[model samples]
Target: MSEVPLPYRVTRVRPETADTVSVALAPAGEESLAPFMPGQFAMVYAFGVGEIPVSVSGIGDHELEHTVRSVGAVSAALCALRPGGRIGLRGPFGTGWELGRAAGRDLLVVAGGIGLAPLRPLVTAALAAPHAYGRLNLLVGARTPDDLPYAGQVHAWSASHGPPYCQVTVDRPAPAWRGRVGVVTTLLNGAAFAPGNTTAFVCGPEVMIRVTARELVHRGLAPHRIRVSLERNMRCATGHCGHCQLGGVLLCRDGPVIGWDRAESLLSAREL
Candidate 1:
């Protein structure tokens, strides 16, 4: 049963941007989906089409949400399914961002484009209990104002509490756009974290991961303390197929989240 797909009924479909949708699903049966920590993903099957790995964007009281961008055949079919429709789901798989390892220290979250999806649950976890960690900084980068997801929540998180702040930048901004415009690293200058005591979780395109990790290291955050999520290396949701390889790690089972010290060499090389 663990290897087979289970049914999940789509309960909500939220339009995050022009091309992106956040699909919320609930178990089709009485059994509840197993709980998942932030950074974990599930293999979603689109019935007639195929299956793809999607990260858990939000864990609601009765549902699990994944932010889907219709990038290809499988994803487009997944995103096209309406509420009340059913799709196949399996897993809350892979290693999560072990927050315990970063306990009592500053948490810096850097996300690019849809990469923010995987990190959303962690933001919720940290902000709900603000007393556990030091300063919490969320830095997000998007291609344009039109492409940014979590628009409403991003504003709310930055405004809510003093210690947790969210800074966003875009590669291109339209006229009258008010926020900063630059790569995500530009916001690093104003981020409040003592390099020695900060733990960073980064996710995005490999280039962005490489640049962001390099920036964090240049600022003195321990290379080992910087964690990154790799999507390029995760083709199959389970390691059984043996296709997803990021350097020596089998991303489906061993990673998708790896330490900067371990990922740096692989990321810089580009093709592995």
Candidate 2:
């Protein structure tokens, strides 16, 4: 098969939270853009710095956006690029959290810190087809209330009793904050989930994923039903580079998203 070409041009770049910025890009011309499943990510390349994989944060009319936090050299460079700057993009890759499987069932999304990026596309997709799913619960956690993403949108989602049930938590609460306080896991206690019919998607730091996954399982979610998005050092979006190999799995190619059962080995393996 021929290689898929990168066809994105920066349309707008705006900050979403303290450390994260949202970038919107559209197709360069008449060429059509590839459709992506929620929870999939695109590999973004900055000419001189390098290429890094980032999740699609929002999809707009004629554009797709990515939420990126300044975490490393390449990311800092991405944050520095102005609107209209040229950047390379290569995906919508990885096995996404399958929305089809959750159809007619409840959907639970748990995100911590920057982990919210990958979950955004899934939320959008779910909301678009509200009738297909039973209930949609989104629980997000951040270092502080100010670090939350899509604050206004999340609030509106929560107000509705249907699919998009949104809730937020913070490690430390400001005086004005009235939402749940403590880790994201703490909020799970009172939430109602139909374990047998519900599928949960989690993305966060390793420790947070571990703790959250444990809680989900304890709440009766099947180990295999829990999907998680994993992060590692990636140099090439293709599997040629060895930078992102964890155990026998190549994160860039095999996943960024994997089922809990499949990831169990690596999650417990040493130096993965």
Candidate 3:
């Protein structure tokens, strides 16, 4: 991973929602960093604006994709970029989903809002090698129908009538919305899995991760079998910055992805 960001040219930008855009990038020069795994992230620099850790939403040959939500200045700059726009990127940083460990076991993916971005590549890999794993299940939640990204693709996965039995729920519904409505955990009751032989990957708001992990454990899934992605306050991708520290763990290096067993107590403790 190069600490000095490499120039990446935006090849395409597709608006996913009112305030979010999916930007596809390719190396602007012969220098490419490294291949990014499913759960890893990159520090995207928007020139004079700043940089932020954004998980790789999609990975392809000599290309990278980021689903940026325009909630702050840096992210807004990324969202505003059009085709041919240039930005700086560094990494293939942090732990990945490590799907190999789950070989021959059922797979469960739970994502909330933008959290789906990080988990998308994992789902795609599982789908690509369906026979390598047992069953694939996906549960997603968003604030509203409009707030959900990858609406078309998600439904397409669900419509496949094969592995990755997908279900989506929303906190609130729009006038024409006709899907289930509630928190993401609500879909857990209907997800197909053999708790003992299943491995789950979850990402979202911390609260959603907590409740979802708890529910999975309650249904007999081992805490260690449940992995979660925590963004925290990762300013520096390297561990030197204490901004992303959670208890004894530095999310930037130690995680962004970690086992629920390691996170349960830390999350329950009150932060001073």
Please write out the lDDT profile of model 1 over residues 194-261, one tens digit for every residue.
99999999998888989999999999999999999988534456776777877688888877788999
TM-score of 1: 0.96
Clashing pairs in 1: none
The lDDT, on a scale of 0 to 1, for candidate 2 is: 0.82
Per-residue error for 101 in candidate 1, Å, reads: 1.6
Cα-based TM-score, every candidate: 0.96, 0.93, 0.98
- lDDT by residue for model 3 over 60-82, one digit each (tens)? 98789999999999999999999
**TM-score (C-alpha) between model 3 and the true structure:** 0.98
Sort order, lDDT high to low: 3, 1, 2
* lDDT agreement with native, every candidate: 0.87, 0.82, 0.92
The candidate that wins on lDDT is: 3
The regions of model 1 sitting more than 4 angstroms off are: 159-163, 233-236
